[model samples]
Target: MQFELQKALPVLERTPQVVESLLYGLPDEWIHNNEGGDTWTPFEIVAHLIHGEKTDWIPRAQVILGEGNKEFVPFDMKGHIKEGKGKTLSQLLDEFKILRKENLAQLQALGPTEEMLDLTGIHPSLGTVTLRHLLASWVVHDLTHIHQLSRVMAKQYSEAVGPWKQFMGVLGGKR
Candidate 1:
């Protein structure tokens, strides 16, 4: 799809709400509770999402908006997790919400399409990328993680034991 800020803005704006709903009232321990395998806990997912925004999305947006170097360095995901370790879920979500808002403002005030294309960033892995493409991928990235969160939540609810499982089954396997 030809992704643009106007096209992706709604999804971007709504993502925080979706994430908020998914995380509401979830026990702190639930963040650490993996799905009986190597699957990441909800907490790790949230942390990763926030990290993606800070390290990937925001910097890329800046590059696309002609505010940063064309040859940007890649961010380390593991380092992000360690740094975010002390933060609570609410704190991380709040930071993400603020960053999202800021990104929206930058997107709204973005210059002409030509100017956007003039900008670039070396993705460390992907090499040089046009600003437009990077912004487009940011939205795609959000949708990917949203779907992942949905799947994880589904697995958690479905595998829930005892009365919770019975109740969730009654609620169409969602709770």
Candidate 2:
């Protein structure tokens, strides 16, 4: 479908709640374990989403809108690691909701026209891209992380599921 802010806003607005609902009050094992290696836990994913709210979405949109920065800064996906170190999961979830609300309000305030949405901006790695792609990406990024969050959480039961693990696509190694 064509990128439409009105259509996208509902998902964008509810993403934080979806995340919070899934993870708000689980035990440490459920909230903190990862798929291992350098992968993020649900806790860390919340932090990363908060980081994106503060640094990635509206900031880059401002660049596209010609508010200040002319080119997108390379996003620090790992910045959440440090930013979230001392915070609890509840704090991170609260912060994510607030920041996302603010950013969405700012976006609406921009009142971008089709011409503005069609305007191009320079991404550090992806070269030139349009505002429409950026907005669509903001919605999809929430979805991608939501999917990642679910998959990572489900994989925590990879071994416990035993014989049924093969049927669980989320746990991978599907036979």
Candidate 3:
């Protein structure tokens, strides 16, 4: 599918509100609640989102637009551990909101054209990615993490949910 900034910009803009509505004012215990195994807590997920806002989407778009076929830097998925340390949930959310707004403005200012969407950049892993792919992935990435945060939070009540686990997909379903 073609990359549609008109569709994507709204989703990107609303991400902070969506996250805040889901997580704001929750107790530390609930925010820090994990699903066990290697899963992340809601706090960790927001932290990771903040990290992405700082480093991922706009930086990569710049590479695709400015340096066609040049190698792009790999994003550190686990960088949140050090980057997010000593930060409260509110700080992370506020930072993400500001960063996302700035990034979106930067993207719009670029005035992307149809040809620009076909521009290529070399991913450190996937290799030879298009601008369309990068932009689409950015939108999808936000949605993926939102769903992930919901699932992680829902699973905190796994035991309390009792027999409803079969009916409650978020508790046991694959993401």
lDDT of 2: 0.90
Candidate 3, residue 110: the lDDT equals 94
lDDT of 2 by residue, 1-175 (tens): 9998899999999999999999998899998999889999899889989888888889888898886557898999898897699999999999998998999999999998889889888999999999999999999999999999999889888889889987887777564
Q: Estimate each model's TM-score.
A: 0.77, 0.94, 0.94
In model 2, the Cα lDDT at residue 58 comes to 90
Between candidates 1 and 3, the one scoring higher on lDDT is 3
- Residue 70 shift from truth in candidate 2, angstroms: 2.4
Candidates in order have lDDT scores of: 0.71, 0.90, 0.86
Model 1: lDDT of residue 18 = 84
7-123 per-residue lDDT for model 3 (tens digits)? 888998999899989898999978998889888888889888888877888888898888444778888989878657999998988888888899899999998888998988889
**Candidate order, lDDT descending:** 2, 3, 1
Candidate 3 clashes between residue pairs 3 or more apart in a chain or in different chains: none
Question: Order of all candidates by TM-score, from best down to worst?
Answer: 2, 3, 1
Least accurate 10 contiguous residues by lDDT in model 1:
166-175
Deviating ranges (above 4 Å) for candidate 3: 173-175
Q: Once superposed on the true structure, which residue ranges of model 1 sit more than 4 Å away at CA? A: 36-38, 64-69, 112-115, 157-175
Q: Who wins the TM-score comparison?
A: 2
Reference-based lDDT, residue 55, model 3:
84
- Report the lDDT tens digits of candidate 1 across residue range 1-175: 7656677779888888788888867886555676567677667777787777667776666665655456665777675476468888888778778878877776676643756655777878888788777777777778887777766666655645555764554335555
